[model samples]
Target: MSLCQPRPAESGYGSETSLRRHGSMLSLTSAASALSSTSTSSFKKGHRLREKLAEMETFRDILCRQVDTLQKYFDSCADAVSKDEFQRDRVEDDDDDFPTSARPDGEYNHNNNGSKEKLFSPASPKGINGIDFKGEAITFKATTAGILSTLSHCIELMVKREDSWQKRLDKELEKRRKVEDAYKSAVDELKKKSHYGGPDYEEGPNSLINEEEFFDAVEAALDRQDKIEEQSEKVRKPRLTLASPSDAYSTIGTHRFANKVEETVQNHMAYSIQEVGGDANWYYGDLKLLKVYRREVEENGIVLDPLKATHAVKGVTGHEVCHYFWDTAVRLDWETTIENFHVVEKLSDNAIIVYQTHKRVWPASQRDVLYLSAIRMIPPRNENEPDTWLVCNFSVDHDDAPPTNRCVRAKINVAMICQTLVSPPEGDKEISRDNIMCKINYIANVNPGGWAPASVLRAVAKREYPKFLKRFTSYVQEKTAGKPILF
Candidate 1:
């Protein structure tokens, strides 16, 4: 009985030790189970994050492509605007036929003989390149505005989409960061508790994503988008403004008037000085010295008998001759044929609009003329050549001098060009009228509105032109004999 009592204490001690070991094993098992669950969850979360990143990448690519397309469209719109500006400039440059103020009040069409014939009142809008300029301009402006508006809308939509995408990316990044932190903690716990030193205890290469690289890519995309938006803004705002039709027309009309005057002056200066007509149409003149030629020209169903006369006179300066020819004050003094002469308008210091009634030729109606008379000093083409003076007269319509029924309206285009040659007294001496010689080239294209017998017209021209030149030269010499020379 004493031996059995000693065994009971030993059995109790062993039972207690076994209970403690079991408790420790259970604790280790629970920890292992929790680690496994955490790893699985982390893996799933990582997969979801990868998928989200892939979707973001795809969306970024699409957005980038869309931006490129929009950029190309904007470039095309800019090109179109540039082309429209060029076309506008070309149209303005081509407006050289006549100014609106100077345009004849009739439509002109080319006749079979290539002369312009009046058809109807010329008040209708003209076309350029078969397109109405006013309508084209309006359409161009509307189209440009539409293009700009569409671009602005597209840009706004793109920006909104980008902002939405960015917000989603930010949320996904936050969730991924939390998941990564939990996974890292789980891995550390597993490593600390692991008994068998295995590769699974360390962080795996594919477990953690490179967040820095992804963030950089997103930042780059956003930067590019911002740049695109800036460019779009620049394109939307244009520096050059389109002018209204009225302003454009007014500017073009002024240029046209100036251009016409310059062109006419150049044409008159370039006309051949030698006799133009053949022997039959030569009229009476000495070809060697004083050459006078006459020719008949038809224009707009009207006859124009143009006369060309070239002569050289001693004891007269070119300035004196041109001055007397151009001055309205002295016009009637030498122009014996002019009955009533008055200035309709003074265009400038060197230009005036004159209304003149010429003495009626026998068997012909009295002719009244309204014309613009201008005087200019032409610089010599070469330094060695002397300066030339010119007086030009062309028919022009004036509001103040409307065509009257008192006399037949005559159209005349006349030019008297003269050059002076001075012979200096062997040394440097003041030049006198005797030393100066004026070379004159006169062209007169007269259109008598009313019909007269051809024979009478020719005979009258033959007698009148010579007499006019002689009287004009003589009067100029008499007037400028003691006057200061004008160069």
Candidate 2:
């Protein structure tokens, strides 16, 4: 203002544009100072906010993990409580509660000399001998509620059990695989040591085994003998308790289930049945096939008419699959009298059926298969066995996954799996403590009745099953080499 003066132009207020610019610059400088202070405060606030956000995120992670852990515990506890409740309730129901009702007299007492008190009991317990007959109906409702509560408990238990079984099945499969590998390795090592005649073999020309190995083998044999005896004792205890399938009808404990099955059968038939008969394809086809193996069962002559069954076919289907081979046997013979055999048998409670056949169609490879299956007379445990002997087997197929297609779901059940990791069979050794075990090799070597027990078939079914099937199918393709089939 002191140094510069604007030239007048019409009416001078120093040049209007210059004046306006000065004012604008002054306003902008004031605004800049105010904005700078605001920006510093905002930055401080944002920094504190970021720190708080980070802490909250950490807390959230910890909280989430804790919640997940608690949920798992709750789920498990709920299941345990439910199972306990159901068991307690079942025992309670069986022991204490049977549904009871009183018939009405169809009369109301008008007499007021405490007669009404007798007829219509007080709703509230006013005295020692008072009865709340009016609340009887409520008591029934409460009983029903208890049942529902027990049911909820059972549902929780079943869920836990289902999860547990699934895990066990997985674990069992892993254990079995490990055991099979160990077994195979042991056998293969023995074979190598025996046939190849290693340095471990005796130096003498005619020596059967080195002293160390011979002693080891003897010890192993003894241990196996001991284990088998122990197992045999356990089995023998139950052998006496083996009840016949015929006695299933007479058994008093099966009253609930017996009535249920009979009712279902009657409903399916649309008429009441005194005694039910299951599907009879078991014996009808046995007669048709027994004509081939007549010489073997001459001691137990064929009798077919009423088809009285020993074991129930309500659980057998191996006959149908065998019938498939029999119906197709004549057409598929290979070059030799020794047939290339592929055989499949279904297990009692399993969904997957197993098959085994020869690879080379002759010689040591497939020769044993025919020998194994030569006992055409059904195994005693099989349904086709005669009614003269009612034999029951207790061994369960502990391997394999649960059957996806068919399984029991109407009730809850628990099955526990225990695996035994065993050492090699017989070898001579006398050291007492470290290597001693119970005996089982005698049964394995004896090949009881010259036929492998059905248990063996079950054990071998899953492992190497696919390979056997593939090889058999390839063998069949090679054998049937474009021979024209008119069938």
Candidate 3:
């Protein structure tokens, strides 16, 4: 009895039933073919195939019922055969156990007759046909169990497959519903358009309506619009100025200045350390940096020695404060020293060459400088580690963009590092907002070119550095008052 076998057709008036069965078989075949061949790329096609498969559920049920009926009959036959074989073995054992003897003068031994044996007797031979009967029964039961297990497994697989298909069908139906809604909306828009005189309709002159003249005028207007756009595309544009990453940093003395700039920024962002130079003489508020100002002459005519400054402000994260200074487009709005600044060479998204002319101070000539600027963020190593932020600036030369004769070229080296430090309150100390504080470390060494008095230069350095830090933090607080902290 094969589960997959097709039923034989019956004769006479059973032809209708046989035909119905044939039709169901054909439907099953079609459903199987659809399941195999249906493309899943389109939800509509998949949905249609699923509907077709659903229609064959009744046929599947019919086939399952027929298989169940056949299995029951097979089990009943095996049981009856086992019982009959056991009874025959018992009758034969009785005759063998109590054989006819010469007891009581030629009297027949009634117990030895086959009809006198009990159902189960301890006198019978223990090994007499017992092994054969037990083996037969065990074999029959195992075969039956294997068949049922296979059928049950097949049914479970079919059920699981149907469940998966049903889920997919539901999703497809939802998508189709959304599409239909969008189509209806577009149809409504078309109906509104039709209710009016339509896009092409227009009034003519002299109280007379002329559709031909109206259409011609509309075509002429559209042609004029196209010509204007075409002319705009023909205008010449300036080329983009970009710097090479290799030439962005300076190699002077024993140091690769570019690598040092990036390393200093990244290291400070990850952890805090002792100040590099002597303690800052606070010029204003809590803003200060190590400053060395003397009348010194180095290469390229240096009037004043290099200057460096560091400052830390409470509230706002390092990222927020650094972004404000890094943006060149908005620097002119707040910076007082900048006269004109523009990016000359763009090497990467976060790196570029910038040209800027500072406003002249007193009798000293105006100054201009070109530099490569880049920004980067170091991610935290662990959950407890805070994120670090860095902005690097190192002066570079651009032959094509030489300083104007009125402005002296200056050498500038700067690195801005920000570290986000969230400290919990100690004891009963009240906190302001988010327990957030940003430590800003600014390092700058700027040598103003040309001749200038030491007193004048030192005064400018002391005055400018403090003001720069204050204005920057103020800008950050104002901009990020109600905004979310990025970190």
What is the C-alpha lDDT profile of model 1 across 78-101, one tens digit per residue? 554455466556555654544533
Query: How does candidate 2 score on lDDT?
Result: 0.30
- Where does model 2 exceed 4 Å of error? 1-132, 155-159, 186-487
The best candidate by TM-score is 1
State model 1's lDDT: 0.59
State, as a TM-score between 0 and 1, how close model 1 is to the true structure.
Answer: 0.45
TM-score of each: 0.45, 0.16, 0.41
Candidate 2 lDDT tens digits, 403-428: 23111111111111111112333577
If both were scored by TM-score, which would come out higher, candidate 1 or candidate 2?
Answer: 1
Residue-pair clashes per prediction, in order, are: 0, 21, 3
lDDT of 3 at 190: 53
Model 3 C-alpha RMSD to native: 30.4
Give the winner by lDDT.
1
